[model samples]
Target: MDWMRDWVQAVRECEGGALGTVLCLALLFVWYCYRVGCEHASYTPESRSSPPELSSAKLRPTLGGVRTGGGASEEELNGFAYCQSPECFRCSRPGNGFNQRLYHNLQDYAKRYTWAGMGRVHKGVREQDRYRLCNRPSIQKAEVFFLPDLPSAPFFSRDAQKHDVELLERSFPALLAEFESVYRTPPPLAPGWKANSTPRGHWWTFYLVNQGTTLALNARRCPRTWRVLGQLRTFISNNVFGNACFSVISPGATITEHYGPTNVRLRCHLARLFTLDAASRGERRLRPTAGPERLH
Candidate 1:
């Protein structure tokens, strides 16, 4: 070993420049080999089989009150609140005086509106063997309803028709334009709430306020966009006795199954924003399912 060392030293001294360069190159090769080996080990099938366990410690409560993370506590988050939650209901009550007018308007309009169209019918048997169904829930599910198409249903009157058109043209155009601007793209203004669902193409919604005003627009309605405006006018003229809103759900998105509280009021969905997936549609998914539907 001593002799070998002596010989190596002599070679280094005699070929110092070449030896140094070779040494550097050899070190670089070893480093490259080590990096390749590490990469292979990291990407091995077994290593990739299970993703790194997400750290529950890093999870946080979102504003919507949903807890996320592998080990997040099942307990509901404090700050996060569902729109349908009792607390939210209290918060959402129209402010005194300000909301009174709004409420009165909606109530009056609703009284006159006789919902029509092919309203949905819910019929099913629960595990208890009891069967039940109604069109009211579908109306509520969509967060809107149509007036019955009858002469007495408030829609057939020429006066009501004129009133409805005036409301749509004056009050709703700006509101609809605002809605369109906000939802033209993904990731709506509200966090964790998409305006649309991935499976359902889009949602069409209408809003009726007190003071004889009506608003209607489709986030994704095509061609005669004005037609939707006209429909709102017609519906309101016939049914706008009480303050109310209307909605339409196009085919494709199954609003999933859900329930609501109270039977005195109904909800409806006005289909708009049509797309392949309802989940990816837009904002407003976070909005409560009208009045009666309860959120689980």
Candidate 2:
């Protein structure tokens, strides 16, 4: 309600003849309202009975667009926390031509800006990369580098451990059971890794968390594994790298040596049964005799 009040007040303060800004703002408002309405409409009383938690989970954006809920503390969650800085709302920078053109109502004004108008007004200014991994001097031979502050070790086991990697390893039986239950029936193993051009065999991924947001239907199917993942805070929850999935690789699959989009995130594998051979040239060859394997 407070946000709504501020948004309306900000609109009122805008001077006349700012037709471009007003039209853009109005279209954005309509889009927001439409999305809200459609979301609510999808959740009927009868539909709420099945997959209740997943269907009814309320997702509100936190600082830097990170979403948090389900009893996880801010510290436990990774990536950038929710932001409420004045810069998040303000657009009227002195001597900025784009700000002056876009935010004529906010230019040189002392009043606080609204969140709804924030995106529109701040369009011209390029947001600084919150985490740059490759630029660090210490980082070398890394494929993707964003948020290089995270642990970049080649491997960790026995002594060196950040979060509870063992917990996931121990819960393999329960997690695998849940995973099999989802893809076992009609839509068994959805084809994945369609974008990768180099893989010789096949790679299929059933994701629980895609870009830090939990998939409702998938989470509903794998409640046990999801709960297990909740115990560990190391999962990359950033926009791109944030994902946890069950990977099924065909036998003799040769996933060519390739760097992920970014290296700030760590890749952990919890194989039910698989033999991986690192080639001399850095290629990864997977030889799996089992049914399916889980990877995070």
Best by TM-score: 2
| lDDT per residue (tens digit) for residues 95-206 in model 1 | 2342345345555665687324313211110100111112212322211122222122211233434554444445444544555554444433422222323222443333
In model 2, which range of ten residues has the least summed lDDT? Answer: 127-136
Q: After superposition, how far is residue 165 of candidate 1 from its true place, in Å?
A: 3.0
lDDT of 2 at 14: 69
Which portions of model 2 show Cα errors greater than 4 Å? 1-152, 185-198, 274-296
lDDT of 1 at 213: 45
Error of 2 at 209 (Å): 0.9
> Model 1's lDDT to the true fold?
0.36
TM-score of 2: 0.42
**Highest lDDT scorer:** 2
Report the lDDT tens digits of candidate 2 across residue range 187-250: 3434322222222445566778865667777777778988988788676654545778876666
What are the lDDT figures for the candidates, one per model? 0.36, 0.49
Candidate 1, poorest ten consecutive residues by summed lDDT: 122-131
TM-score per candidate, chains pooled: 0.23, 0.42
Runs in model 1 with CA error above 4 Å?
1-84, 87-161, 169-176, 187-251, 256-296
